[model samples]
Target: MNIKEASSRLGISARAIRFYEEKGLIQPAKQSSNGYRTYTENDIWRLQTIAALREIGMSLQDITHALAEIDQGNQQGLEEYLELQQAVMYAQWVELKRMMDTTQRMMDLNRQDGSLDVSHLHELAGSARRLREARQNWHDRWNYDQQAAIHDQRVQAGKTKEDKPFSLYHNYDEALEQTVQWISPVSGEAGLDIGTGTGNLAGRMLNQSAVMTGMDQSREMLRTCRRKYPQMHVKLGNFLALPFADHSFDFVVSSFAFHHLGPEQQQLALEEIQRVLKASGTSRICLTDLMFTDSAHRDAYSRYAATTGDAEQQRALRERHFPLLGELCNWLGYLGYETKHIRHNELLHTVLAVPRP
Candidate 1:
């Protein structure tokens, strides 16, 4: 096969194959008459091996050394090299996951406030150093730590007070109540809650005998959560990349947290959700947050916010990538989830998504 055919078969770009060739990773047969390279079976196998290693986050130098070991038939050397590379990739995965969380946080900030100020840059710089500290591994844009201190209190308070000009939860307590009600939990079944700040949503399910593990990026929030329920398993994690294994849970749930991610990030979170959910046809995901019914609702909300002259409302409109119900369902459906929309009000929505039988 020529480079084009090999590239097509490998599903990698032609440029990448040429670059690999330049690195001496693989030597293909060259026609004497024209000096054109033609990939043989051995060459294709080497190329495939190189691509696999690279996919696992190997460097070019590392790959070259690994391939050299194989060429020399040094099985012991190749094993050691692979073991070392595995450790390196594991560390890289942790750091990369942290960086991805931080990047999404900044993207969310830029989306919400319409600009990232000098203060934002300073925060980002400080966050790099803070990553060494607990809870700093993932920096939440909304400062959930501060919110964690009073999250439940605020929700309870909203229940009794006059309605605010704008709130992420149309009815805070009601949203949670409905979201928890919608989630059908079987006794002893494993469940995970992403962005499970203070264990509010998971707490209700736990009462029903669901084996719940709550995960959040905020350390302070998790601390409060542990205080509330010392026995429950809790971890510091974000939605973009769930820390659990594939098909680990019977169900996953979250509330008032999904909007923390941008649209693309939301899709990424859903991908993680689908991975962690069991292949059992009954496995499902339940999430509640401020969202639009559709594009028309989003447009009308913008006009309503503008007319109200509430900067907070206007800012909320701009800052929040409030998901559209139809779009979210479409994303869920693409990932093999059948969805049911439960609208709490004009702005708040609960999506109950389950695997299609």
Candidate 2:
């Protein structure tokens, strides 16, 4: 069968089939005179098996290794891999349940006076911070001091029109332009950029004469941001516990950073963003990481990750808990925000949200 036929029969896309081939996961039996690849029944079965493994949350690397073992007739290794995956999935389920319980507790604290108990909210925030700190490994993954030293070089390389290291790093100028356009920073308005790595987003807002303050967990990154933009304020902070008062900014923005956080942390970060924004204020944000819209999409991302050779990045990808777009939208609605998905791509998402009156 041709690629299209295989795709149709398996309920997968032609692009996905090509992706598997690119990863060396499948090989067609022949190439026709027209230069089309042809697959055999065995190939189709192999593809179907791969899709099934992916649906079960197996990473591409894991799937590849398991398949190789299976081809060699080693069923024991496959069983071991499945056991490990089951443990990981169970842990994630527990964490999710904890987050849900926390949310419910917070909701229960709302008084009959239509006001939230400030002290109770603070306690919940502290719980969230603790949960995130326990699960997060970014401090170990990123060497902020080293990254800061080469920050300008990396940014310049990313801006070049030639081959780039990663899609997120490609076309730096274009990405920044799109972020600024989506944010639409107003002159003299106060804005905050969370996880402001090297102040890229903050700098764009500052160019519009907006009062921009940047926050990041890495002190070294904040130092770089300060040296580059002396006029803007840079703070050493994390998303779970923002170092600012309530309703402090007219707008808030973040770019390519939230994926470092766990699902619970993402929710806590959004709450903090909303807290720091003035009533009816907007937040235009971009997330450049894997987003799992469904099981199939999650599997597709795992395959994409297999193509990358960066071990640290691959580990981060494995550890990261991507929040589903629908779940995020629901969270926004529950928090009294009107949310709009500005752009949804395979590995990126842009959203514009405003507090509802």
Against the true structure, whose TM-score is highest?
A: 1
Off by over 4 Å in 1: 1-139, 160-163
lDDT of 2 by residue, 103-171 (tens): 887877874466676888899979866875655543426566678778768767654435433344544
How would you encode candidate 1's per-residue C-alpha lDDT over 1-357 as one tens digit per residue? 999899999998989999998888887889999999999989889999999989977789988888999999987556555655654544456557667877787777778755567688669857754543422233366787778888877767655425567755457777777777777788998989888888988898898899999988776788788899877888766876576667899999998788877776687678778878888888889888888888988898798888888776787777667888899999999988889987777788888998888
The residue pairs found clashing in candidate 2 are: none
Counted clashes in each candidate structure: 1, 0
Error of 1 at 132 (Å): 22
What TM-score would each prediction reach against the true structure? 0.62, 0.58
